[model samples]
Target: MTRSARRTRRTTRSLQVAGVSAAALLALSACSSSDDASSDSSSTPKSSSSPKLTGTVTVFAAASLKESFTSLGKEFEQAHPGTKVTFNFGGSDTLAASITGGAPADVFAAASPKTMAIVTDKKDAATTPATFVRNQLEIATLPGNPDKVSSLKDLTTSDLKVVLCDKTVPCGAAAQKALDASHLKLTPVSYEQDVKSALTKVELNEADAAVVYKTDVKAAGDKVEGVEFPESADAINDYPIALLKDAPNAEAATAFIALVQSPEGQKVLTAAGFLKPTA
Candidate 1:
């Protein structure tokens, strides 16, 4: 072979070898880059984004839950930027009736299971009701207990002019249970439809005292004095909460219920003179 041809052949072989080496290097670099990307992806945590909550969440709650639930509602609104929490605070039975009667409510928080059953029995609750807190009866008297009402029996004094919640109300039912347990009878000046109304009697000086929840007396602050009795232990009412079946905003309603069952929500309730639920 001619020298020029031999040289050309040698040069072509060298270039081919270099081209293969370059292609191999490129493949190795690409593999390394892919491995690094996979390792980085495996080590990194995915960002958790919660669904945005919006619109109004209407809650029908017992009168006794007014203070604490109101606070929770505000916190819920703040945590969920575009959401609003509206409440219907009233007698548990009335609220239950409203729920069963097709009133648009996102949630229900009742003072007693019996009242909650009024809605649950009709399948109006989206979820099984869970007890969130419990409350016991207390004698609410004028500030400083002006009449010296020291015990449940003291409220029985003919001239004391006590007030009581109506028999249908949880507060009234619990008060009756306590009275029955103590084997003492109380003749109230009037029977109010709800606990707040019954407590109002004492705060406004319309009645000397009233049988109500300790939470209510605490909420009244200096307006009324609280008198605890041993019989009240046997008459504690369990407050239960549930998501309504026909809730306008079921997602937000469920979230609110979750918040109420959370530790932060319990702190608010406990501070309002509510007892932790046993079951």
Candidate 2:
């Protein structure tokens, strides 16, 4: 071959080799970048999946939540070492007012959506409230049902002394709804501030009967007897829960809320006679 042709051929071979080297470097660089991106994506979920919760979580809940929530709080404390759960149980409206008044609560579990709306409307809730459970009204009579109160109408008898929750509270509102649904106009001996108080009147025999939550009657054990009435279905109260907007322990609050919505939490609530929330 001619010398010029040989030189040209060698130059061409050198150029081809340089091109191949450049392409291989680009492929390696792209593969490294792609691997790094995949690794980052996979790790992102691990960091956010489970929150590390610590510190004290203060929860303001409805009076009706006293029993089940206390049990659930203990379970939460047991599951999260170094974390504490403090509770303030009262009427839903009262608790909502307290939260809106800057009570510095970490969470709020209300007995009714209407009461929860008071806080949410004030922008005191961190997230939209979720209905966690339901409750029904029942006639709580003296032990052994001495008055023989079989239904809501039976409470209207002139001789029977009936107590009811005040109109401001969820239980009271439910009781009034049930009464209205049945077209029964019975005057209660006294309108208590909360369901527990109404049930207490029956338990103490101060009132022969009371319209209170089924859960309250159940929690009272042998102190009072529960009589379910069909009208109660119309006044079923939906319980809702939410994390407070200015929570002192946000992580712990979130964890507590998650625990309460879990299957184990449902078991505890249902065992206490609270109806499960229907999806």
Judge candidate 1 at residue 101 and give its lDDT: 94
The digit string of per-residue lDDT tens for model 1 on 202-231 reads 888899999999999999999998998999
43 Cα displacement, candidate 1 (Å):
16
Off by over 4 Å in 1: 1-24, 31-48
User: What overall lDDT goes with each candidate model?
Assistant: 0.94, 0.91
- Top TM-score model: 1
Clashes of each: 0, 0
Q: Estimate each model's TM-score.
A: 0.88, 0.82
